[model samples]
Target: MNREDFWEIVERSRAEVGDTRDAASAAAVARHVVARLTALGPSTAVEFQHFYEALNEESYRWDLWAAAYLMRSGCSDDGFDYFRGWLVAQGRVVWEQAVADPDSLAAVGVDPDDDMVDCEAMVAAAGDAHATSTGDREAFWAALEQTEGDDEPAAPADPAGEDFDFDDDEQMRARLPRLAAVYRPVQ
Candidate 1:
């Protein structure tokens, strides 16, 4: 799909999420995201990063999970490596702070029965922070620039010429009805 169409799908998906808290609704949303990503074909790490950023900004848990799953399924090694690196970095910060002063843990008041503090929550928090940052897009561009260096090599673009028109009322009318059968409106 073309960039505009892809973004339209993303936006519509986010709107569908709303304030949904039901498990089935969440699962359906996640499935839709996975379907969209799969249809998009091969995706680069940078592209996946952008998807994650957008999903996080919209507070779409399903989209984030679907993106993570897609990254794992299509790019196993890269996905695992990136996830592991994130986990390690988070662990280091938590552990270093805890060790430096045990009282830090007391502030959060860890439960004795709860063996490990929820790492997923920490990862999600970090993702949220990154998504909300005004400088995040600039940082991503800067990273890309640094990688390009002096060699201004032209990059290949997607071959599929289909354009996604998310704002098209007709398109939404056609798609939403079919989607509604599976995806109930978020209450």
Candidate 2:
């Protein structure tokens, strides 16, 4: 699937759940996405996984990591993975905006408990669908490796751009004033 198609799937899933968010909501969205991809056929489902991986790679930036860290009070390596998935689930506009400017996420209206911010289910949507389509998780990944070969988005050796201490208040305030304002980094 192309980027537009991938995003459309996300949009449809969000609509299926009325744009609600939280762990349960994220799982519901994942199920909807799986159903949609199943109807689209196996190859397309695998392609969707490719796009999802690419988008996650593109979003693996130090600045955006800082945004996730503050919004979630603190974020680990895996937490940031889920956070990127949540960002994609928000649809194209918010994803693009946050990617362009991490501070822009300060306006995304996070869930009160921030469960939506750690949406692990969103990251697994395409893979679950791929398994349903191919009837095997291993088969789905093999197909992805075959089709997406050199084109697959590889994980970055380091997050793009300068690294900084996400837990440090002064750095967060200086690097992402807007997000720091909304989340107010703990002293």
Candidate 3:
């Protein structure tokens, strides 16, 4: 599946189910995606993983980090994952704009000052997609039920986490002046 195809799956799933925050809703989407992708085999899995990775990388920006920080009152390590999924589900325009310049998100209504942009449905849908692609049936459902604020096990680990320096709030603020203006760093 290509990026557009992956997005179609997500959109269709969301359209059908409306919300994916609960395990039942997420699992329903997971079943739909898994059933649809089953015919294509592992290539579909690889494509989903690749698309998800690129989306993850795209979100590794100061502006988006600041938006996530303000939205969550300080984003946790796992919160970044949900944020990336949320970014992807914002659809092509927002995704492309954010990738090109994270500041563009402000124009797209992702202002750091507004903390009500809930991305739980998007996050759950992406988790379901990952579950379908990887054949990890239980993990996604279990993740949906989890209440400990831990990172959901949507996909397997990628060792490239060492590449970003998200911990440096000062540097992020320097990079995103607009976000800095609207959001005070949460100590």
lDDT of 3 at 43: 51
**Residue lDDT tens for model 2, 1-187:** 5788888998888898866445566667777888998888888887888788888888989999999888877888999998887777677898899999999987777753564476787777767777886779888868877886775445888999899988788999999998887788455
Estimate the lDDT of model 1.
0.34
Question: What lDDT does the true structure give each of the candidates?
Answer: 0.34, 0.80, 0.56
Please rank every candidate by TM-score, starting with the best: 2, 3, 1
What TM-score should be assigned to candidate 2? 0.90
Best by TM-score: 2
Q: State how far residue 67 of model 1 sits from its true place (Å).
A: 24
RMSD of 1: 20.1
- Tell me the tens digit of each residue's lDDT in model 3 across 1-187: 5788887766665566655433345445555555555544545544555566666765665556655665555776676666665665555666777666665555654445445444544444445554656678666445434432355445434423233454466765666555554565456
Preferred candidate (lDDT higher): 1 or 3 = 3
